[model samples]
Target: MTDPSRRRVVVGVDGSTESRTALRLAVDEARYRNCLLQIVRSVEMYEENPESEELDSAVAFVRDDLGFTEVSGLVTSGFPAMALLEQAADAELVVVGSRPRSAIASVVLGSVGSAVATHAPCPVIVARTSGERATPGARVVVGVDGSDVSERAVDFAFGEASHRGTGLVAVHCWQVDHPAAARWDAEAFATRRNEHLRWMSESLAGFQDKYPEVQVTTSLLEGRPAVLLTELSRGAGLVVVGSRGRGGLVGMLLGSVSQSLLHHAYCSIAVVRPVVPSS
Candidate 1:
């Protein structure tokens, strides 16, 4: 088990533009946290030796550019996702660049980012390459749905906000199904919405109490969870969500909100997974 007192951050590099951005972000984060930075590069079976050479150059560039004196580099041979997940075992946070290919062609969260986020022993950050800048006073946003997994996500978001000295926002989205021919009932809908907002406020009270220093905001929206989260992420420095929730098969891989937000969210996203229930 990783000691909570020790500071360690792991970042994956793949010689892409996105990967370079991730390296920079990782270095900055390490400096901010005063932690040891570990650069991990993975090589698949079909890749040639030149990939390793490129990785070496990339590592040197990161070290020189970031001026990080305490850094470690590792080159491993295996599936990229699996190797990174294994390395994340002892890390406080795992950072990876968003895939370079188109969203349709690319594996959304199925690649290194998604795989590690789902299975890693720690929080995983998926850094996007859209050239979005994190505003100085930007808050960290987290989605909550009253599930155990969401509670874990709330814990991570609170910890991160405290660590970064930023504000935290908790968002809950609700949807009310209606028949195709049914008329909209504005009054009744408003009453139900108010109740949901109250519930959300109560549910997030613990997080606010735990991190009193961190500013907290609670929002209740009427729409799809993923859509609301994507919209909220526009002004956030980081958005966090749970991997699996109170949905279908508990043993299934990734949850729906995590899968959708991973592909569509604008800013960096952290997908938190609960500890697997013991048999």
Candidate 2:
């Protein structure tokens, strides 16, 4: 059981390099937010000593390395996704690692990071195993698609930007009909792209009005959404996206674009979902 009054951040660790990276990042975030850090390791019910001594060693390393004062480690027996989702119910944020599936897996079989990001009750951070830059301040980037999810993403991005006192960049992307035209009509596309940029600006106007202190910029590109988003993520400290888009099943697993971005995006990605109304 979790205490509702205490702020908590849950992170899943499985000993993978990506998972280790996520654990380190989670520790830093937990320390910065002054929140309790809950480390969860899930294993099959049949496995003996579920989270073996090795897992304990890793948790100890995180505690010693990050100097985190408030930390708890738990070993649970269940499916990874289910265990994480249950743990996330009381968390302010949940962090997980991205694992690429083999070629035999279905195209829709997104990494566990994507699945948890799509279904967790709280905000999910999908951390990749990339080297960190010694940047002073974090950058917040939000993906916009004119849907409720996108709106939530915008809200999360702005809120984070305000919290971190960093810049917020709103990005939208579209596919080009002709490959040649994509290069030839760069200037013409700029004008059309401005329209989309304007739309994003208008969509996020309320957030701007609410958080007047946050600096924000918008970009619209004519290309594959995932590709463009991943490219923009290179310089961002945090990238935000909705669990699903306009075409996805609401309140379900992550949609295509969100799923794709989780694995390939350069920065730490936050997946936001709409608030479910109580019955």
Candidate 3:
């Protein structure tokens, strides 16, 4: 368990452009949240080095360029995902970069990002690019499916929107019977759309009330959830979603949409898992 009193943000560094971008964002987030910053370097078994220049440079960037007072750096040995999860056990958020350099790199990095997002105890931000900037009131989009898992994502989205003083777009996507069938039965399509809108409204009602200052908009669309959300992410500053939903398999940790966005989303993504109540 993480220390209860200390709040920290951890960033995994691997000397890639994505990792550097993740480090910068972690610094900005830590500064905004007024928390300590931790830079974690993951090394394979035979390549572990105490005097790694990349690690040193990352720490230097925080201390010199950013002027973060409480910065800690660690060199952990193992797979990057497992090392990060253990090192950031007490962190408020774990930040990682997700751009792949090659096909094999894509498979490797994708697995790392997906594993950490699915199993991490806290929130995980997968930074895909170096130039994503959010103004004071930019839009933050979240996917909702009216499940307990999605409710947690809604809560995270609301809190983020409230903190940034931005608007929240809650998207609920449903499939139509068929395009040809819908063309024939306009009334049936209308009824189905209305039902989805109603469910979306009810799912977001509490969040709207809690964060009254946040401008809330609901989108009910007919398409694949992943494609729609990825399209919406283009105009959004951040995309948030639950690890799984109603359609997820009983034994799977991540749903298709969440997993898909982790790799394809242009903007930063947050994969929020359902909160497990402490025993």
Q: Can you tell me which runs of candidate 3 are displaced by over 4 Å? A: 1-4, 46-51, 100-109, 130-138, 177-181, 247-251, 277-279
Quality of model 2 by C-alpha lDDT:
0.77
Worst 10 residues of 1 by lDDT: 100-109
> Each model's number of backbone clashes?
0, 0, 0
Q: Over all chains combined, what TM-score does candidate 2 have?
A: 0.79
Return the top candidate by TM-score. Answer: 3
lDDT of each: 0.79, 0.77, 0.81
TM-score of 1: 0.83
Across 37-116, the per-residue lDDT of candidate 1 in tens digits comes to 88888887636678778677777887787677677777888898888888787787889988532446236435778777
Error of 1 at 201 (Å): 2.1
Which pairs of residues have clashing backbones in candidate 3? none
Q: Residue 62 CA error for candidate 3 (Å)?
A: 1.7
Clashing pairs in 2: none
Which digits, one per residue and each the tens of the lDDT, describe model 3 over residues 1-279? 333377989899988888888998898778767778888888777264553778898999888988876787888777889988886678888899877323343374566787898788888888776244445456999999988788888998998787767889999988886889987999988988998888888878888899899999899888899999988887577899988888665335788898888867667898877666677
- Predicted structure 3: lDDT: 0.81
- The candidates, ranked best first by lDDT, are 3, 1, 2
